[model samples]
Target: MHNISKNNEKPEYGWFVKDLIVAFSIIGFIGIIFVSLGIFLTDLLQLFFIFAGIFIIVLFLWPGLGMAVMNIILDWKDDDITDSFDEMKRLEIPIILDIGCGTGRTAMKIVKALENGGHLYGIDIYNKMAISGNDLERVRKNAQLEGVAEKTTFQYGTATEIPFEDESFDIVNVSSVLHEIHDREDQKKAIKEIYRVLKPSGTVYIGEWNSRSAQLIGYMGIFCFVFKPSKYWEYLLKESNLTLMNVEEKGGFVLFTAQK
Candidate 1:
């Protein structure tokens, strides 16, 4: 097993931290400007400016800081993925596929949880904007550092056109990926591909953000509009002919477990 010494090295989750810092800086600058303007104004107008400045800062910073806490400090994604794995029935020598396996974050965790002998194949288009240094080589290196390289494989692939035979995977995992497909038609095609690649009675786990939830509104603010509601995913699963087995929600995220 390939392993990296745990001296000072750590997994890089991406530019989220840097992005949050930038956002905070901008918010602070704008807030300062508004407060400065209020000092020169008169009566109710001054009060309005001061309050509006504080409100704007709080409004956006609440979500931005919350995201930092959940993603960076708490590493909630790992916990959520592990919870999904715990729900699955044990399969001997399972053949697993991780869609949109960015930087091997989710894929490595899944492989580590496999007590039985099995291999995990991860595929991603490696969209750089999705995550800092998101590429096949980075994922492979991460697997090696995590000491799961021998049981894991990373490659370039898309959800709409999975480069594998029908019924190839015993289990499929999609985490916060389908929403990136954007177009509803392409999203449906991706679901169909997932269904096609699963063996009979195979299980699929899909994790997505619920746009309609209060958690999302609190954490993402107006940006939550980017995600679809949980009902949309249920409809997609039904449309793809996959039987929805269970739906789990936590921290504004939803996990849909289905069977093929």
Candidate 2:
């Protein structure tokens, strides 16, 4: 799956770092055995698994390191959020929806982006994700920590079918989650749902990977093979009855804002 969150993490069989650690452990152990048996000396393929093991180990132990590396590769900027919020101020008590809110990070960021008080709804398929803190209780606790729980509502749901009424929100933010849905049709449905839920003149901000070096893209591809992160426009095609507002590229990610 693509795992689009506002910017980043995954469930059982999903993004649990422990899974990577286990895979690395097994690969490393087997790699050592193969190397000692002279298999790697003749067959270089064994070396690939060994290095991959090391990379996974690094990723498991220090998640921040991975984000740091991505920043270097993508040229991350912090101002896109500021701009998004500035635009949101035009509405009164805007109802903001955050789709794919892994561990509530993107949801919290959206809460902070609001200059004035606004009701925020966060949705996620967190049942199987493996981020450091991803349980429903943890999300609730995080919202408490952020002091936005009263105004925020976290729900277990998928982007394909948002659980809300039509024209219920003034702003909808799908950060980094669209790419996680491997099926192109599902991605389009998610966008359609967002469009359906948005009121006329409402705004949407989709933050997802757009441009990146071949090496980096290949690297991420190994971890998330089903991801179709770049073909984002498929979800916001011109014929979708939505108006494209602004498109900005920030490093490896692109933020596309639109109006409905």
lDDT of each: 0.81, 0.65
TM-scores for every candidate against the unseen true structure: 0.86, 0.71
Off by over 4 Å in 1: 1-8, 15-28, 43-62, 76-80, 86-89
RMSDs, each prediction?
A: 3.1, 7.5
Model 1, range 1-260, lDDT digits (tens) per residue? 22454774555556544465457657856776887899999999999999888777666665566565556643543463665665343787889999999887778878888887799999999887677778787887787778788999888899999989999999999998999999999999999999999999899999998999997777667667878999999898888889999898987789999999
lDDT comparing candidate 2 with the true structure: 0.65
lDDT of 2 by residue, 1-260 (tens): 11323433321112334444445445545544544555445446656655655554444323333433543443333233545555677876889888877777567767766776888888888744345456677777667766677989888878898889999999988877776786768867887898999998888888876534354454343443334445446355555777877777654556788889
Cα-lDDT of candidate 1: 0.81
**TM-score top scorer:** 1
Name the 10 consecutive residues with the lowest summed lDDT in model 2.
7-16
